[model samples]
Target: MKSKILLNLSLFALLISSLGTSLHAQTYGKNGMVVSDHHLSSEVGVSILKKGGNAIDAAVATALSLAVTHPEAGNIGGGGFIVFMKADGDVTTFDFREKAPLAASPTMFLDENGEIRDNSNHKGLLSVGVPGTVAGLYQAHQKYGKLPWGELVQPAIDQAKNGFPMSFGLYRAALQVSKRDSSYDILQNFFRGPDGEVVAPGELWKQPALAQTLEAIRDQGRDGFYKGAVAEEIERYMKANGGIITQEDLAKYEAVERKPVKTTFKDFEIFSMPPPSSGGVALIEIMNLMEEADISKIEFNSTAYVHLVAEAMRRAFADRAEFLGDPDFNPEMPIDHLISKDFAKSRFENLDLTQASKSDSSKFGQLYGGDHTTHFSVIDKDGNAISLTYTLENSYGAGMGSDKLGFIFNNEMGDFNPVPGITTSTGQIGSDPNLVAPEKRMLSSMTPTIVAKDHKPYLVIGSPGGRTIINTVFQTVLNVLAYDMRIDRAIEAMKIHHQWLPDRILYERNLLSPDTRDALEAMGHTLIPTTNIGVLMGITYDARLRAYVGAADSASEDGAAKGY
Candidate 1:
């Protein structure tokens, strides 16, 4: 059995290298599977599964593991949403997204002159939100976890305490930080040595502080961090840095359980995170528009098909910028209207087909809604599946951590529109529903989704790419379900994205041919080349074989899909 597993991994690695992606992108395992952007984190989850844990247990383990092995995207200092399906056919969602501090205000990021404040919401302690990751994971475990909480988090604790070798992926992620800038406190604190040197790849790095932090949370449950020493440490740093998060805010933080948005496309049920995450609404709208237009008629990856996808993406994002926000803060969002087939049809009719819409064109849009966020998908032998996407908002988050506690804070407040109701060059008011507000969660595009066919788990998927997340997942779904590509091909295929305001179609550098770019340009679409848009981590289940197929985005440098 061990030999067979090793052989499969070897073959998978070869296959991945043939595709010109990192060997870390190789697929692994059949019975139970874990796919994440970090190999160590994925292994941690696989270990949990081997220890008789369920999909939820694997997910929580993977998330915690990433907080240590892949801090660029995974983080305890951040928060995200989780969507899962139980073996008995029940689907659920948990929204543990960070919220604005009590002292937050709608105009807090606005200057005295009523203009947007420079970097006010992007950097420093003022940009931090009340983190909900610890609460979110704990709540999920309390309800569904099959393993003890301490057991689930033990792998992460060990990794932090004993140290792990920094992989090429961690090296690249660390390189993204500007070590010279001491103001980037989180980045500096994470990668810089006390002597002002930077940690490099292949080195064994340990974080005893983070290990101790995790151990406390394991021993005392949620209060260990939120109401005790950790909370006090966080408050002290904020006070010293002109930030407003208080112990009261930490004690009051709660992860909410919300209804998953459910919809159908060609007989498959799509389940996704609802609001605070514009992801589900926007994704549903885009899929509905594609269904209404029958976009499958065009050849896959052809300019025509890519153009259709890009147009659909643009329309969805335009709607998102207008309507999607924290439901509690913007209760008037037309959730029903936006996700309706009628709305998709109306929006589709405005498309010219022969040419791109003018850049400045104004239209009422129903769209839905990554950064250094990490995402993972887990499936256990019991048929339970979990899709989770979590983040620190940006690389290292807030570019600083609590000096005493040695953990970073999420810059989620940066997600809110700093200056609401401002007119843009596109002639539409920018970010109305998503404006800053006290105790309100910021709007996000992290779409942790699970899709089913015949009431069985078919696909579990999510990604990390800031605003590009929704579209990346959107295209991947199309690649597999609509175009009939294999899961690996669906993940490796060149992708394109378009957000309405930017009015430029962003495509992988070599994915589209010169002629394709010219054809798109001739059709009035502006095309821009980019190295990457996002990394998608996912797994699909084959009921007939009772096997799980895993995949990680080739665009990423490190990730693994392993199962046992």
Candidate 2:
């Protein structure tokens, strides 16, 4: 009887484990490409790849489909960063980060008392930044795309015309809305039907407005979004709501090319967005510091290894706060002083094996994001790879929706400095250089990277966790090169981070050992255990087979690792 009971108990446990796995295994298509995060968006990309499109074509398709499917984050109303590498070792960066309107004054958000209005005059017209995504994607496709422009955009239009089944991620984001001012009637209509209950996952969610906007773009191309009537509607909406966005701002909007920040680790040369993107340059600095350590020799997840890496992160972040800024505007960005070999060495001078550093000096308190974002990486048979990250600055940005555009607007302007007296004519604001200006771009921590060995592309990776994005990319690369873990295993194994804020070392449990934890505690380091850092995805080339290797975050039951 006792033996039978034990057997039954074991069987019950096995059944439970299997059920959990099935619950989270995100859907994928038959061969070709894989989609994770939101099942439908991934499928949109996979559909294009299966249709004989290259990564560039698929990206445009996936991105536009996301507009109809995952409007909360996958957006047309927002903008982002893209990094691409061609087979010949040529690299480029596209900066469509939203721009302030021409009428945007440095003091636009200031009240009579001189304090910045909450969210910088949050809501109505003042909430949006000039959108760059349509233009940004258009530029990449024009240069590198193989499929017909209209062909790539068709999937998005169809999905929008019909609709897509929503998922938990979308519904959960809607149920937990914040800082949302539904001042406009169309905006209030987004989160629910007339019943006022939350929309259910897998329910068909359609945005006819989004379909119309994409249709206009499909008919006229990039001009439809930037210089045409669609652009006019956006401007009209803004100007009516006290927004300073003008026809001139819409006309003047252009996606300029910024330099890509790059470095090398072991066999691979890593490249990412430069300057204004604090994410990439900071990644280089952390890599420079971590290069001094032998990561693999130590026990995996041993406290000593964790402590060293976390300390390097703290130091690098301190420098990021003090030295980095947007180059075009500030013009004084100390690139040499920030990622310089000498500067990185100078940051390591204190080199304590023990204590966490205060972000107080860094002047950035906990940047617990009040936002939502997404990332996707693509590799074609031709050795072309792209890692792109885009956002509305926060989920359901400014909590305002565009009635005409069939999308929500970005409140990226809040990312700017809010002080009335303090100005950014210099672009240097102690540590917060990402602050706002008229037609100015905000600083973002979105790091999109590609790694190469001997001038040949090897791996392309990127993530979307705001400040955590830098550390996540750093550790993933370390796992692949120094730790020698397969790319998938490296991303899945575990993660820990220290953003130089409270000096508290944050990490996940079970992956790091008790012995390592005690050692760090002995050194006066306060450790934080956290899980679900966010999604990390990429495709790696298997040189021997000339095939592909890919991975996706599996925190959700609905994630997949698909490729051909």
On lDDT, the leading prediction is: 1
TM-score, cand. 2: 0.86
Assess the local accuracy of residue 341 in candidate 2 as a C-alpha lDDT between 0 and 100.
Answer: 68
Candidate 1's residue-wise lDDT over 1-564, tens digit each? 999887656655543433334444446466699998777788899999999999989989899888887777688888999998998878999999999999998888778898767777877788888999999999999999999999998899999887776555566667777453877665665755446555555555678889999999889888988988889888888898888999999999999998888788998988999999988988889999889888778888888887888888888888887788888878788988988889988999998788888655344332222267878899998889999999888767777886556577888888877765664553333457877777899888898988898887888888988888888888888777788776787877888888786678889998899998889999999898998877888888766666788888765666878788
Candidate 2 per-residue C-alpha lDDT over 445-521 given as tens digits, one digit per residue, 9 for 90 to 100: 78888888877667778776766888888888877777777767777877887877656776776767777788888
- The residue ranges of model 1 lying beyond 4 angstroms of the native Cα positions read 1-28, 175-178, 192-197, 359-370, 426-429
Predictions in order: lDDT: 0.82, 0.69
Q: State residue 145's C-alpha deviation in candidate 2, in Å.
A: 1.7
Candidate 2 local distance difference test against the native: 0.69
